[model samples]
Target: MKKLLLVLAGLLLVGCQSGVELRHGYWVDLRHPAQGARPRIKVIVIHYTAEDFPTSLATLTDQQVSAHYLIPRQPPQRDGKGVIWQLVPEQDLAWHAGSSFWRGATRINDTSIGIELVNNGYRSTLTGREWQAFSPQQIASLSALVKEVAQRYGIRPENIVGHSDIAPQRKQDPGPRFPWQYLAQQGVGAWPDASRVQHFLAGQTPRARVPVEKIMDLLQRYGYPVTPEMTPGQQQTVIAAFQMHFRPADYRGLPDAETAAIAAALLEKYGAAE
Candidate 1:
């Protein structure tokens, strides 16, 4: 009897230490301490796995790239039910954001928690035929997860961004159809004020040659990785990414009146902090 009691106690202790009581899933190791050993999480990077639900699960589990949660698209039910899989603990670093930067900080994989939603991405189609949107059920689950994690980590609304927002040139996941404005309405991330942009643009002189350097500076300030050595093609890519996020109505990759106006307004609104 004494030996059985001791064995049970040991098992309980092990379970507690492993945090296995929290959820059900295969937890894989992808640990890397942040530089300078910061204890706080500064960003929440959102992504869409450009694969089906099952394939994403296998890749995330087998490959080195991992995220804190995998919000899969379950089949729609009459009662509208869905589930979110917690693939990793929030406290550990997930190998998702690679060579990324935001708000002057680099190596975002260290300071950010990544959450991947299973969607086929824009390579599918603009009609969203190839990709799947989050069901009402899935959104509820995802919203709850975002709220829980953001509150726990003291993450700001602006810090919660799509993977493409941080690494625009190399990525386009969680594409334009991701309903970012809807998320912002829920206090998740920043949404540009279209009226403010229009007002700012109205004030600009006609055919004005706004400083390209200043526009680049504003993008870099907002964490877009605009460097001095960037070639014209690289510049266009970065600009296109910015347009995708801010001026989705037009993304011609040209620094036209509208793009310049938006960039100017953004600088006016948020550039002072930098």
Candidate 2:
């Protein structure tokens, strides 16, 4: 009876503390956490669901694709704030980033948390396709969530990226209208300094031809998955991806002074430190 009482007391104490619990019909004292360990979550990948809340929820829960959290376009109010859904736990892996690479890390799903926002993505109109804009409420909720997760994992500002950033060729979710600059203002992601960009921009005109190889080198240094084997078209796709993130005004995939300058500024701010 004493032995059983001691085990029960230990279990009760452990339940009150932050530690791993085992359930093999007995409780083991494991409260001493290892100092050499760190969280596997190093990156936070933002995405757009490309569907309504119901459809996105259904697809994420039923299908193979999943994310750590989902913010609805019109989230239900709770406690005077919007409510977001958590589809997957942070400790587990979510298959959101498929065939992706960033900062020399491939299979990004292994070490990242994915956040999905409900959006229609884009609609085809008479003139052209119109991309959807994220709601202010959605962005607010996302900012809060991202701040919390980044704090928990000590994720860097540059590590907070969109789905298109890690997989440029095949994906473009959380697209041009995602307001990356706004997020950068909130200290969530990377943004090139305007002054530095202008400093580089001052050296050349809009039509000045910057070599494609030099631009590619700058992008690779800034953390895109550019490689030597990529053809001209593929290289353009990569450049377009970079522009989509930094220079959303035009993403023609062609090298220009502004593009090169922005790349250089980003490298100067983020890459040089690393």
In the range 1-274, model 2's lDDT, one tens digit per residue, is 9999999888777775856566677656578868999889999999998898889999999768999999999888899788999999999999999999898889999999999999989889999879999999999899888988999899988899989889999988888898899988997888999999999899688546688998898888888998999999988988988888998888878988889999898888887423
Q: What is the lDDT of residue 262 in candidate 1?
A: 72
* Candidate 1 TM-score versus the reference: 0.74
C-alpha lDDT of candidate 2 relative to the true structure:
0.89
Q: What is the C-alpha RMSD of each candidate to the true structure, in Å?
A: 7.9, 3.3
Mark the regions of model 2 whose C-alpha exceeds 4 Å error after superposition.
Answer: 1-36, 272-274
Report the error of model 2 at residue 97, Å: 0.7
State how far residue 52 of model 2 sits from its true place (Å): 1.3
lDDT of 1 by residue, 115-198 (tens): 888777754466633434655665666777787788887787768877877887788767656767777788676666777677
Candidate that scores best on TM-score: 2
* Candidate 2 to truth, TM: 0.88
